[model samples]
Target: MEFTAEIDIMPLDALLDPQGKAVSGSMKNLGLSEITNVRIGKHITLKVKAKDKSEAEAKVDEACKKLLANQIMEKYSFSLKELVA
Candidate 1:
């Protein structure tokens, strides 16, 4: 079976995000003051081949823990969808 993993990686709430703050400041300069406390993150999409949903999920989680996300500074979450055909 083939699965699609959609992952989101973000800095922990306790951490400061300079890029997001920069963007937020720019937004205010552009007259979008209502938008504040912006935090930037990463989104990743990948396809995994496995025998079943559980196997695919495990693989995706392992990938996230081992390489995709930094456990110390960032947290990651993912959702898997089975691909048809």
Candidate 2:
């Protein structure tokens, strides 16, 4: 079976995100003041061949934990779905 994984990686709450803060400041300067506490993150999409959905999900989680995100300073989330032929 083929599966697609959609993932999001973001800095941990305890860590400071300079890039996010920079973007937020820029937004305010651009007159978009309603937005606050803006944070930036990464999105990743990949296709995987697995025996089943459960296996695919486990692989995705492992990838996120090992390479896609820094567990100490960042957190990750992912969803897996069977790919349509």
Candidate 3:
């Protein structure tokens, strides 16, 4: 069977997000000061081949831990959906 994985990776809340902060600062200049504390993150989509949901999840989790995310600075989460075709 095959599945699709949607992954999100973000910096730890305790860590500073320079890109997010920069964007937030610009929001004020753009007359959108109401937006604050904006946090930036990444979204990834990939296909996995596995016999079952659990197996697909395990592969996606491993991919995040081993390649997609930096555990020391970021956290990751993913959801898997079975592919219809």
**Each candidate's lDDT (Cα)?**
0.96, 0.89, 0.95
RMSD of 3: 0.8
What ranges in model 3 sit over 4 Å off? none
Give lDDT tens digits, candidate 1, residues 3-80. 999999999999999999999999978999999999999999999999999999999999999999999999999999
Best candidate, lDDT-wise?
A: 1
The TM-score obtained by model 1 is 0.95
Each candidate: RMSD to true structure? 0.7, 0.9, 0.8
Give per-residue CA lDDT, model 2, range 1-85, as digits (tens): 9998999999998888998888888888889988877788899999999999989988998899889998998899988888889
Better of 1 and 3 by TM-score: 1
How far residue 71's Cα lies from its native spot in candidate 3, in Å, is: 0.5
TM-score of each: 0.95, 0.93, 0.95
Candidate 3 least-lDDT 10 residues? 76-85
- Model 3, residue 9: what's the lDDT? 98
List model 3 lDDT by residue over 30-79, tens digit each: 99999999999999999999989998999999999999999999999988
Model 2 per-residue lDDT at 72: 90
Clashing pairs in 3: none
* Number of the candidate with higher TM-score, 1 or 2: 1
Residue 78 of model 2 has an lDDT of 86
Instruction: Give the lDDT of residue 75 in candidate 1.
Output: 97
Per TM-score, the best of the predicted structures is 1
